[model samples]
Target: MKILIAIDGSKASGLAVKSAIGLAKAMGKPPTLVLMHADVPLMRRVAAELGTEGTRRYHQENHDHAMKSARTALKRAKLAFSEKLVVDDAGPAIAKAAKGGKFDLVVMGSHGRTALASALLGSVAAKVLSQSTVPVLIVR
Candidate 1:
């Protein structure tokens, strides 16, 4: 079995990681786990202001920051896993990775925005659930 978990450096995502651990244990084998962090693109003006190298650094920093806690937790659990940092919107990126990587499942944490807020700002979880070919497990 293969699982891809989205990490956004939040407590909710940490819960998702814990759920992933339990799920893997229940499967009776150590499944392949992949930690993915999606980098929201910077505004055009900001990117231009940062220049090429600076922009690269910005994304790299963001990736590191987002992956930090998730990585620590996985390591603490004695789980072997790989990680990826993709520069794209979270919803599309996760759905694409789940399909492209041939993962059996995609797990992510949701802030559980109110209906109005979700409608206005759009829900990443909803988008992923709609677009993903694989099943998605959302932890609140």
Candidate 2:
């Protein structure tokens, strides 16, 4: 099975990573895991202020920090996986990756927002669920 795990450096996302590992193990076969981080695009003004090198450094640092916990979990589980960092909206980015990669499942964390709150703020998980073609396993 091929799995895509979307992480955002939150406690919930950490749990999602753990859940994906458990699911893969339960399947009784080594699955291909893709660990993905969707980075928010920097504002044009901020990028100009930071310059090319500074902007690159900033994005790299943020990606490293965001992937740290997920990487550690995968290492501890002895799971081999590829890492991807994309600068785009999280939901659409995840959906595009899942579809383009032909992954069987996409695992991600949910903030467990109330219906009203989610409707008001537009939840990433909800958006992903709506847009994804493959099955999405949401870990709260």
Candidate 3:
């Protein structure tokens, strides 16, 4: 089965990845895993301070950290999955990516954060549920 695993370097996202791997193994098909890291734009001050090259370097560092965290999490679960990174915020970008990619399942984490907290935290899983055509399996 094809699975789009949304991760944001959170503990919850790690759980979701583990859950997806377990599901894939249970089904006897190691899923075609597509990992995504949505790049949340930085603050204006931070951007200005970083300037062009510095900002680019900062973004690259963030991307590398996200990828490294994802790889470590997947590795701990012993799951093999391909990865992709997008230069957009988590919510809308994740939904768009999942739909455009035609994934069968959009596996993600359920943050216990409430509406206000979710808004502040930028809940990609919630947005994916709202907009994605594919079925979502949320691992809390």
Candidate 4:
């Protein structure tokens, strides 16, 4: 099985990674794991000020920061995996990657927002559920 875990540098995201690790242990044979981080683009003004190289560096830094915790956890578990970082909206980007990569499962963390709050603020997990072709497992 191929599993894609979304890492967003949040405590909730850590739970998602931990849950995936537990899945690996239960399955006996570790499945293929892919770590994905989707970072939103910087504001136009900031990007313009930074220029191309600086913009690239900014993205790289954000990606590195977001992946650090998840990467460390995976490494400590002695698991083999790969990572992908995209500069786009987290919800759609994750959905696209999960479907395009043909992953059997997409694991992610949720904020557990209420219906009214989620409706008002918008929810990444909800968007992925609506848009993704692949099945998703949400860990809170």
CA deviation > 4 Å runs, candidate 4: none
Model 4 is weakest, by summed lDDT over 10 consecutive residues, at 21-30
> For each candidate, what is the lDDT?
0.92, 0.93, 0.81, 0.94
Model 2 over residues 43-84: C-alpha lDDT tens digits?
999999999999888888888999999999999999999999
| Tens digit per residue, CA lDDT, model 1, 16-91 | 9999988877777899999999989999999999999999999989888988888888898888899999989999
Hey, what RMSD does candidate 3 come out at?
Answer: 2.4
For candidate 4, lDDT tens digit of each residue in 13-123? Answer: 999999999998789678999999998999999999999999999998998999999999999999999999999999999999999999999999999999999999999
**TM-scores for the candidates:** 0.95, 0.95, 0.82, 0.96
Distance from true location, Cα of 93 in model 3, Å: 0.5
Better of 1 and 4 by lDDT: 4
**Which ranges in model 2 have alpha carbons more than 4 Å from their true place?**
none
Which parts of model 3 are misplaced by more than 4 Å?
A: 43-52, 76-78, 119-122
What's the lDDT for residue 35 in model 4?
Answer: 94
Q: How does residue 81 of candidate 1 score in lDDT? A: 92
